[model samples]
Target: MAQVRNKQVLLKNYVTGFPKESDMEIVEGSITLKVPEGSSDVVLLKNLYLSCDPYMRILMYKDTPLSLGFQYSPGSPLTAFGVSKVVESGDPKYKKDDLVWGVTKWEEYSLVPSAKILFKIDHTDVPLSYYTGILGMPGMTAYGGFFELGCPKKGEKVFVSAASGAVGQLVGQFAKLTGCYVVGSAGSQEKNKLGFDEAFNYKEESNLDAALKRYFPEGIDIYFENVGGKTLDAVLLNMRSHGRIPVCGMISQYNLSQPEGVTNLANLIYKEIKMQGFIVSQFYPLYPKFLEFILPHIREGKIAYVEDIVEGLEGGPAALVSLFSGQNLGKKIVAIAPE
Candidate 1:
């Protein structure tokens, strides 16, 4: 046969509140191995590693798009940031067997437009799976949010919520690299995993404001906001005068039928804090710069990245659903095919 079997995880229905494993189904389909005769710049890809991020939850809802920029339709295979190897390419820029990472579907094989792929994977010294987490989008999110938005200064106190996450882990590391004092918070189950100077369990803290006060006696100079709601409210009360808060993800509120209200917004004014919400696309122009800044650190062992990888396409849905429960110890990844 000139075709290959494509195994896919399709969204069975639009998610209402919290997602479940039953929300997605694995479907088997067939695809031509070659890019069609006259197609230009269409790349046939063998998907390898899929990055399971919290933003994907937003897309699972009927109304909107996440970073990949498209709403998820019922019965359609979901799209995500992933690592792939080109099986065939009708484009000059990519040849057979080129390793690349960017937007790809949650399937064993994918046919993607060349533009969907951000760029060819140039460095092979690191595990290709790293492209799904540390060396790719999540890493960029932390770099742009913390260094560019949070604007850490030497000796400043920094705090990151959901710190063991794909982006937050890197954010704490970046804060430490800038000579700042770093503290992180995770769910009670994951607080013991080390990546920050100090760590606490948010689930165990009765008063988040008191928790922040205990960690940052003076005040936090930079707060890398990940799980919003109560965390943002508490951080607001503890922010230093003229402090910066880079709004990354609101994971705590994403699956809520009614999003939680953050009552301490007035604290932003009281403390003269700068709270800015940003998406990763705004930082793509600086990707090359981010690579130069981060690659050396990664190679020197100055940075550490942890990933909780689930092997096989069948496990994709559960792996993605794990984010809301804080089940993943670090970056959640779904491995489809071996590189």
Candidate 2:
């Protein structure tokens, strides 16, 4: 194949609050499908779907460190996890037409430096797009954090805040599969219908603490904490003794210039609770184990997933900005091109 031109979404500048469409620009650039001469471990890929994660919104700040994830450098394209088809490879491990999932540039095409963290999509029987989300990062997060950290037991009562988001939805379903009673909180009533045994519209609730109490009259045994702050405080007051709280994300705190104060800390001591915060990257070694556990369930139709897909790179900026407003219904993804 010959080298070809590619379209890319470039970061126009650092951002604050919700990002605007003007913060990014789509431009065309050229790259060889063939690896450049002397390159030994590079893989060129055509991006199929780019994940629009909430974390990307935090990276729009120029001061956000590379350790958090790459900062979207000015004049350069943003990056994210995505599913792609390899068009060219300079590494012996990869070949043309291979389907893979890993970090990819937010553009029509990406040249991966090395396929180290990338994995091949062995289960083509499932949707290849699933690799971009439910079967990928979010899946791993739910499996590791909920099962491993939350340590849920059958019949235990579980609560998930931001329950309709990517990780929370899967966590709720996983709990149901374990015979646990599960309740979830979402911003709207429509999302409440998907999987939760009891779903409440957080926005409609007059008092968050009262709402949680109403759902878990016997108290919650485990909490998959996605939205922190007031939700966390409310959950704290309602936890059963020795209950587990796996702190996966605090999407509620991401946009605030300063974090909202929580007056309660004595509950952690009084209840003898186990509340731990974690980043999914810390659970990488368990990836293979997670795949082993989830693949069968997914294949058997025991698990379900939903996605909010935007048609092209042009919609990426607005779609990402919508995360703060709870505008996305499920896992948000950008279909850069056709499958």
Best by TM-score: 1
| Model 2: worst 10 consecutive residues (lDDT sum) | 64-73
57-99: candidate 1 lDDT, tens digit per residue: 9998777745455668998899889999999999889999999
- Show how many residue pairs clash in every candidate, following the order shown: 0, 0
Estimate, for each residue in 226-335, the C-alpha lDDT of model 2 and write its tens digit.
88889898889999999999988888887777878877778889889998888777776787887888889888988888888889888988888777786457888889
- Model 2 TM-score relative to the real fold: 0.95
TM-score of each: 0.97, 0.95
Positional deviation of 193 in candidate 1, in angstroms? 5.2
